[model samples]
Target: MRVLVTGATGHVGRHVVAQLAEAGHDVLAMTRNPATAAFPASVEVVRGDLLAPASVPVEGVERMYLFPEPRTATEVVARAKSAGVTRIVTLSSGAVTGGFDTDFQLPVEQAVEASGLEYTHVRPGDFASNTERLWARMIRADRVVRYAQPDAPSLAIHDGDIAAVAVAALTEDGHTGRWYDLTGPELLTRREQVAAIGDALGEPVRFEEVSPVRAREILERQGGWGAENAGFLLGFDDYSATGPSFDDVDWSATLVPSPTVEEVLGRPARTYAQWALDNVAAFR
Candidate 1:
């Protein structure tokens, strides 16, 4: 089968491309800057952006791994359908059902589901890679990591695991109309995650508690999230300080890891400690 993957430069998208190529499928990686995008030599890289579906070439592409860009979903889907595409796998967030980051993710998922195409939603909770953005600076500058709600537990997932499930959905049957609620093997608190990173580096990492207000600013500055977006991101910590974050408040109910990933991929989801150990060089 021939497949087209948008946002091919992203962490998960890159992995999806690699897995599909390794499966011996004809893969086309879509990017806004094909010249700068370094896809695998075996895969063909094309010029396209989700924001501008008009320029995205859809000819001969049988399937798509759509990065969630709800604004242009209809156009992209129509273009794909017109070009004889049958399957679409979207990279979505657990926020739709969990309401963690629903404001943005929900609309995207809705658009894809309503598109009348065979679609599978790849919904992951907190990403294990977030540690790099949240704590990499602190760990590199000093051994101190500051964040709100150090004890608040979350089932952060590895990006590669998310990609693995996405590849399965794209290439295999029985996955259409399914939502893979992906998560790490274990739930760990922010402090625990920092400790795990330190353990990977064979050093001691100190954790200092900061207020949500301060963390919001840090997220906006360091993570490049906007002010309101940063507030919503930090809201997770604030709500944790009081109770569960969403209107449907049930922390213990959602704390357990989802088996969908392992069931679909035939392998256990990666653990946060394992993710930390795999990317230990980033801290140095």
Candidate 2:
């Protein structure tokens, strides 16, 4: 299949492009800046931004991998439809159905549902990768002062798992019209997550809980931690305290004969410990 992937330079999109290429599919990596895109030489890197779908050349594209953004989702979908794109696998947020009204994610879901194409919504739970962003400062400082919610359990899925599921949906047929809620096998709380990293590093990591207001101030000082995202993170933390009644569906059962992270990476999926060990340089 000739596949076009938007957000090709992003966290999840990078893995998607690599996996699609490894699967021997013709891959077109679309990014705003072709010069900076790090896709392999085999990939046809194009200068296309989702914000401007006109920049994309989709003449031979049969399937698309979409990353949801507040801007241009509807326009991009419309352009893909006109260009003969038949199927789409979108990266959606679990928060959308879990009753979190983040305007950005909800509208993208609406657009995909209304697009009239063979679509599969990949709604992954909180990504374990989010910890990298959230705890970066703490890691650098060797200490973290958080909101003190230790018991808020989250099923954080790995990015490669998300890409594997996306590959299956884009290349296979049975996945169309299905919304797959991808999650990790185990549930861990924010404190437990911190402990996992500490255990992985063979070092002690400390957590101190501050008032929400103070936490906001701390996040604001960090570049790229925008007010909206900071607020959303705090809100999500509070929501986790109450827990999400994420329906009764057994996600593991649906993923029978499961697509292992190893299958996607052609190696074992990095556990929290492995990820911590590998990325220890960033922390130090």
Candidate 3:
């Protein structure tokens, strides 16, 4: 099948493209900036924007790996349907337990399903790569990180694991209509995760505690977050600090780990430690 992968330059999308090519599928990877996209020679690189998906030529494309961008989802789906695309596998968040993202993901899912395409939703929780966002700067600067949630545990699947399930659903059968809750093999707390990175780096990385209030303040100051956005972000930070609590009736769906990756890919999921080890250069 001829497959077009959107967001091909992204962390998850790159893996999807590579795995699809390995499976002997004709792969086309779409990036807003094709000149910067460097995939294996087996894959075709193309210029396409998810916001303007219709602008990309869909001729001979049969399948797609869609990242959720709900705003233009209708137009993207409409164009896919018109082009006779048969299947769509989306990269969705496991945060659907409740939040702005849930509201964002559901409609995008609906758009693809309603587009007369076979749909598989790959929902991954707290990507292990997210640590890069949270800790990279601090790690690079002083090998010290401060955050509100030191003991808060997360399922935190690898970006590769998320992409593996997506490739399984896209290329193989029996995955249609399946919702894969992608997670790592074990749960680790924020402090433990930093320690794992430290191990990978052959150095010590210290975790310092910051109050949610103070953390938001620091983020607002250092990260230049608007006051409102900082608080909104802290709401999630506070939630994560409590670990896996379904206490909030409204946000009950906070992601919990499942054996979906092993079940789908026939192997144990990747460990956060391994992810840290693999990308250790980023920390240094």
Mind giving the per-residue lDDT tens digits that candidate 1 earns over 1-284? 89999999787888898888988999999988887677668999988888888877789988999898867887888888888988889898876666555445566677767778898999888888877867788799899987788998989998889999999999899999998888888888889999999999999999999998887777667654234356656664432233345655666878988898789988898888888888899898
Tens-digit lDDT string for candidate 2 (168-210): 8899767888777666656677787788777666777777778
For candidate 2, the TM-score is 0.81
Best by lDDT: 1
Q: What TM-score does structure 1 among the candidates reach?
A: 0.90
Q: lDDT per model, in order?
A: 0.82, 0.73, 0.81
- Give the 10-residue window scoring lowest on summed lDDT in candidate 2: 253-262
lDDT of 2: 0.73
**TM-score, cand. 3 vs. native:** 0.89
Runs of candidate 3 exceeding 4 Å displacement: 97-101, 220-233, 236-247, 250-256
Worst 10 residues of 1 by lDDT: 236-245
Candidate 2 wrong stretches, greater than 4 Å = 143-147, 236-271, 274-281
Better of 2 and 3 by lDDT: 3
Task: Using lDDT, rank the candidates from best to worst.
Answer: 1, 3, 2
Q: For model 3, state the Cα shift of residue 216 in Å.
A: 2.7
Arranged by TM-score, best first:
1, 3, 2
